[model samples]
Target: RLLTKMFSNHLQKKLTTLSTLTDLTISLDGWTDNSGNSLYSFMALKENQEIVLDILDLLADHHTGNFLKDKLKEVLSINGIKILSIIACVTDNPSNIAKVCMGVSVYEQGFRYCLSLSETARPKYPEIENITIKNIISDRYHFANNDALTKVIKPIVDAIGRLESNDSTLADIFKELINIHQQISQLEVPINGLKAHALAIISKRAREFDSDIFFIALFLSPPHKFLAISRKMSGDKIIRASLELAKTWNFKKIDTSLLFKDLLSYKNNDPPFDTPFKSSSQSLRSYWSEFTGNAPLLHRFAMKVLVIVLHGASCERLFSSLGLIKSKIRNRLTPDNLSILGQLRNELKKTVHIKENSNKTVTEFSTYNKARPTGF
Candidate 1:
């Protein structure tokens, strides 16, 4: 118990530092453990790093949207994370989780807009698109159309897969959706029939998982700054959305007027932004880092938006470790003990090194040499 307290304190300090360093995307999902306890895991992700935030044993509490929302608030408050520091909240079950996003205060307005946008973006009966394709395949008694459909659906599936990556950002997701729309639009008539249907579904699903934050992130990303124009999304609209998001994030020190001007300069490819980058593969973080002196406020804001992780896969991934730790033989482990063990396992994976020699792997605690506390 003493060691568990020490480790818990160490992990809490690390989470506090993470909250201060960058904006986080809170990814959450629920599952049942071997002991029949209903567990919901919360993970905080930014850029390429993921921190396990908490695992709640819901016990007999109903998992309704309102109930989950209060629990989410409790977790954030305990971890010292401010509501404004969250870039997005992602989960697999959108129908229920949507309430969690929309029941909050000012942020609820953005989510409300998302729901409205999704409704307006599609026809009332969008499933007819899929039914049309199926009828064609059945009536014609041919499989060629099936192959063509695969080409269209494969890209969309791959794009969704990319979201599960730890490094995926909001801009990456936006770009993928746009690319899928374009790819579908370019297909010939019968295949193109899927265009309106595909686009409507994409817009609806995208908005369900995202909000104006996505557009702002796309505008901030260096390579994608001009891509939105191709989709008829006006620069002014994106700028206004960016400003609104900044306000919601409680960035009081930002000079909106100067930030607007800097946005124009980047959009127009003026001055510093005009100079071609030395490498086409420059990362978003590194690209934004270079502009801190020239566009301080914009740089600060961009860094926050660009670091957001787009999916709840990290939270899901943690469940595998949780399952192993709480196997049938270990079903009696308390939730506190489970959480401590899980965090220690994660931390050790980072600080320990494994070397292979003569068909044997040696485990070495590298942090011991650096005099870092390992909570032993």
Candidate 2:
């Protein structure tokens, strides 16, 4: 009991610190555990790190849009996080979650359909009439269509995976969306039939990309600036969006003329931008850090926008961890205790590494003291 109290206090302190950050992206997901408990996980992502905020057990509560929205507000309020600090909220493509972020910037995961046409759309041969199943399987046209569909869907699945990575940025997502559109639009034959259908879906889902914030993120990305230009995204539009976002953050005294000049120089690959990085694998944030003195405004803006988390994988990961921690044998654990234990496990994962050598498990700590909060 004493240990649980200590951990809970530490987590509260972390939450207090988290509330002070600006332009944070919140990721949410929900799932049911083996013991019939409905659980919802919330996480906050800033820069490259993700902080597991809380997990709620919604006992006897209806999972409606308004209910979920109120619960989310309660969580944010308890943690001292202001709505203004949240740049975006990411979740799966569910109507309730969409409604929760009605007035706020939200990004829903793209449509996911099973690519295996036969397995997904049809039943087993034994289950259906043998003759009918045989005829469907023997159709050459069906095979051709399935092959074409796979070609289109495979790239989208790969793009989704890239976007879900911890290091992925809004710029990366914008580039992927553009690449998907181009790949379909520039096909050898003009759009028709399956291609046209796929293109339409992409267009519908790409509506979120119409927001200038996404374009601004792409514009500020050093490696992707040329890609944005080639895609015909307007520089003037990006500038307007940047200024608008800056004003929201209360940067009223910013030099608009200097920002414009710096953007032009950046786009043109002038002196400071011309130099190659010391390492090819340098991160976008690190790359932007080098030019802070020359492009102070852009650098400050890039640091805020470039780190937006593009997926809800963090919440999904928390659910997975919770499942293991709250197994059948431990099914009786209370919600408060479960949350504390789950958090401790997550913290340990960062500092503890176990290696097996000579049939023995050896545990190593990168920063033992840092892993445990004060007084633990």
Candidate 3:
């Protein structure tokens, strides 16, 4: 019971600190433990200072959404965790949890719009006057005696058909029709000279134009494909400069990789420390040599805490403690009592803070003294 109380105190402190400092990115996973009990694991960056793994919930054989939601609510209440700032959820393919609405499902579809703007060689002859040609090619030339233009638009119509009755995808089809009108706004060919070849060329270009539009739509998509384009742009100074044309009004977040590279290359021996510890501890020695040259003890301690805690082992150890405590007693536990026990176990691992005296110099002593009796 004493050990359990210490654990609770430690966990409470960590959870409080996490809530205070960092924007959290939470991931949840459910699994069966060795004891054949169902458990949900939650991991998050707490306070951006520490990574914490928590047994967010435990459940009986019959688990449901209500069970999950209730457990989430319970955690929030205990931690005083009001809002989730960022969330990343991972699950198996065709996961039912992917559903956003009842009886309605969404499937991601890939589309490419082909534009005729890029020419391999010299420019072709000027396109004939103002008929909107679409890229959709079909063998049929006419629909209800209207002409071949109507047949070219069948794909848009078909896409709209899949949507719910009178939905906005149907409206989007009409919007594309208007876009067609705008494309041929400058064409001046006489109606009588609208030859088969001219119509064919216009149709081809229209298809290409639709493809361009599709690509633009992809930029506004979820799981955006712009990262590849952004990477290419960053590689080209001219492209990056062009993107930053508006000096005052045009600013964008530089990609993190670019920012980190610039930060690391600030000086000949910058970036202070090497995280992966390569080559004989040379960089680390250089960092301390430079740091201890001027900085105080408090600064050294701050840096030490930052570096030592960066690795994920801290959270892993916490998880092991959770297993040690909860695995045997979970079936007999209540949620509230289990949460209390989890909190106590977490605190036991952290070092206690002892304030240094103002007048006296701090000194290290090596003698071991027993504060309490040891028992196996």
Candidate 4:
């Protein structure tokens, strides 16, 4: 009770300080736990703040799309989060996530084919795009259309998945899409003749992310400081994009005098944090940290845009810690108690000075509980 309350109150106070914050990315994903309970996970980040993972209970019986929408609204409302604050919602191509992204399904066919293709033997997609078989020859198209097609197409799919799983990946989507486009262009050539239609279906889905928000995400990242514009864009286009982004952030509106003169001057200049971190994941993490200190405006945009980690991998890892605290013997733990345990453990892990596995804190809690409850 004390542990969770302490950390919960502390974190809430921290979030309240983000009054000026906007465009926050909150990745929502749900899973069935070892106890067969359907629970959801959320990971929220903005600017230079640490990613906060929250495990929320899904008390309803069915997990339909509409139900999920209401549940999420409730969660966000309780946390005082705004829908407009979210830039993107990342999840493994699940139907529910698709529904959440848009009110309805846009890529149902593509999603179905993506799964069927992931397996060893491809599920019969019947007819895809322009390819058809009236006069039957061999089942080559049928058999090869599934897993083999998926294997050939995995380069693009896997790369995008890598981008999705990135801690600070939202900003890299557009740049990475360019990379995917290049990969597909490379693969499209070798895939001539009869198997061409399969490639078309795969390519269409890969190129579906045409939103400008993706490009904005790419532009904010330090490594790809400017999204790889060389393929379809020139220096002129680059300047235009920077100008527009600047305007979108109201940079020009704030200081209208030197709109082009101020920002465009740094146009081609390289950010000191451009290079990749050789070993640490925190390499990219450091870029925002450094920029926020010196450039608060750009930092705000970076925070507004950088968001996503769909598989709930971070949240799942959190569940493991929760498991340690609320073991089988402690299985009777209430949701409130479990939350405190989870948050307290998370708080402990965040600070190196606070020994996580140390018995001192646990012993102190034990002493306090025993002393208060006893007649002594």
Candidate 5:
């Protein structure tokens, strides 16, 4: 009981700190354990800063959307967060969670198929052409009668520039921009011809830019993160196509600066950085190794990694710990007790690792009786 109370207090403090921070991205994953525990984890990063993992919940059976929604609400309630600060949700590209229908599927299918198929059979996708009409829905981008494609592209162009930075590569920024384009393009109804114009614009920008430093810097970061984004977004298709296109364009080799010698040595020695391994499974490990074993392996490697990113693997690990902590005597655990156990497991895991320059402290100090020491 005392251990449980202490854990609850620690969790309250952690949530309070996170709530005060601005801008957070949330990622979640579901898992099943050997003991048949169905678990979910929630992870948050404040504006690309500190990481917070909340074990969120564990269940006896499989998870569902309503369960997840309630878990999210529970976190919000505990932290006293009234509104979401930022909303970047990262989930696997193959997640069936997002594809589930919330309403009557029959009605929705009938509405979209009935009239639309008749129009589409004539090769007239009202859905596709509606894009142009939607653009005219507002004359905001129009001067006189002609639509200004330049005006439509400026914001997207600027976003690409910000995303470009020294920290990202042509491959990185290009993939992101193309994803934005794909999303706009994939909208059920073409709100405007804006998407068609946007893709052309991004493609032009990618080809014309001459920035080698940015690409090199991007490659320096561990390739694992690239896999996470690509896997979650299905943005690998965009990257694969971009890299192929890049081969045809001539650009100056990115300078390696002072570490040129070291970089070259690394290139010669290490088995070139392959795509990140997604799991301990033998098939995925073999698949990644063979798929990424090549020069200019960046695009292929990223594709393999993104196919298997998981946000909540660690949290699910804690639920395993919970079973151990609860034991058979405590099998019928209360929600409050389980929550505390999860928090304690997470907090204890956060202790920093000591390395080469480990801090040294004297465990024992020499003590002297002043008069006796003087006489001696």
Candidate 6:
């Protein structure tokens, strides 16, 4: 309990330092354990920081949308985390779309159909009548159906993996989603099989990428701004929305009219910087950092909004670390101790600057010797 309190106190200090992040994107992810325990983890992402806000193991008989919404609101209401804006949400279970993604419905039908088999068609025994069914015939029929459908659905599954990959950023999702839709629409399914089912599943999700937060995040990226804006909203409307977002944050030194004019006339190929960055290897973040003085409000907005991760993989990331720590040889490690160890690991990763990590803390510190080392 003392250690948990210490971690909480440390979080408060970090929260105070990050108070300037008036705008935040919340990622709520839930996972179920083998023991039927439903656990929900909440994470908050800002311009330069990502932290696990809280973890709750709900004791409910079932998890529902109202339950999720209330728990999310409760976590953010504390922790000095106001302005609860959600840019994206991901789930192991695709039952609820609920402002999560623009077209989350596109992804739901495929999942729903997987569980729609009628009770009578499914029986514990191979046959109910006296005659036993031919096992080979039943197996082959299912295999043919699965083969046709799997070919279509595999790409969409791979696309989800890429989008949620640890290193992926918010800018990566838009193009991948568009490509998945194209692939889904072109699928040729068997006349009476799961191919059509598979197609509908992906096509539904493809068209659901309609969230305004998605467009704005993609718009902030110089490489994607033009292609990322939703056709539903005009270019002028996109500009207005971006500016309105800034005003809500009470951003400093924003000449709203000037910013609008500047964005209208801006060209990515010819950035305001004196030296054009030629190599495609140059990142958009670097470009925005250099252009801050020229377009202060615009730069700040891009820095904040574009920094969001496309998924909440960060919430589950600690599990891998925990697995390593609590291996078969060390499985007896207590939960509280494991939690502290995990926090220590993450807090270290966020260290900004380190002069000499291995330096001695006592009177004298030894540096790496330039001279030969033969082991004394």
Over the stretch 1-376, how does candidate 5's per-residue lDDT look in tens digits? 7896776677677777776764355567665444445556665643223244555447753367786777777866666655435334444333223212222233544644644664567665434356665464334423322223333444455554454232332245544655656654554433356567656766775555334322332333344224323332333333333343333232123312212333342333455543344654433234333544444334333332222222333333555677676676766765555656666666665543222223332222222343345646
- lDDT (10s digit) by residue, model 2, range 303-364: 77877787787777777888898899888987867877777777666434322342242233
Model 1 has an lDDT value of 0.70
Candidate RMSDs in Å, in order, are: 13.6, 10.3, 23.6, 13.1, 22.0, 9.4
On TM-score, the leading prediction is: 2
- Across residues 1-376, which tens digit of lDDT does each residue of candidate 3 receive? 7756666666667676666743344444565444555556555533223333456446543556677667656665565555543322222222223122212111111111112322222265343233444322211332222332233333334433332121121123223443444444434433344444444654564354332222222221212223213432222332233223212222234533343343233212234321322335333223332443222332332222222211233344454665676566556665445545654544333322223432223333212223344672
After superposition, the stretches of candidate 1 with alpha carbons farther than 4 Å from their true spots are 1-6, 12-22, 94-153, 181-210, 230-232, 328-330, 353-376
- In TM-score terms, candidate 6 sits at 0.61
lDDT (Cα atoms) of all candidates against the true structure: 0.70, 0.71, 0.37, 0.53, 0.46, 0.60
Which candidate order results from sorting by TM-score in descending order? 2, 1, 6, 4, 5, 3
Error of 3 at 366 (Å): 7.4
lDDT-wise, the better of 3 and 4 is 4
Residue 350, candidate 4: how far off, in angstroms? 3.2
Query: Clashing pairs in model 6?
Result: 102-208, 102-210, 102-211, 103-208, 103-209, 106-204, 106-205, 107-205
lDDT of 6 by residue, 57-156 (tens): 6757457798788888897777666664544344444533223323433545553343333224466423333223334323435455545556566666
For every model shown, what is its TM-score relative to the native structure? 0.69, 0.70, 0.32, 0.51, 0.34, 0.61
Measured with C-alpha atoms, the lDDT of residue 352 in candidate 6 is: 38
The CA lDDT at 289 in model 3 is 28
Q: How high is the lDDT of residue 34 in model 4?
A: 47
Give me the displacement of residue 240 in model 6, in angstroms. Answer: 2.0
**Weakest ten-residue segment in model 3 by summed lDDT:** 105-114
- Candidate 4 Cα deviation (angstroms), residue 159: 2.9
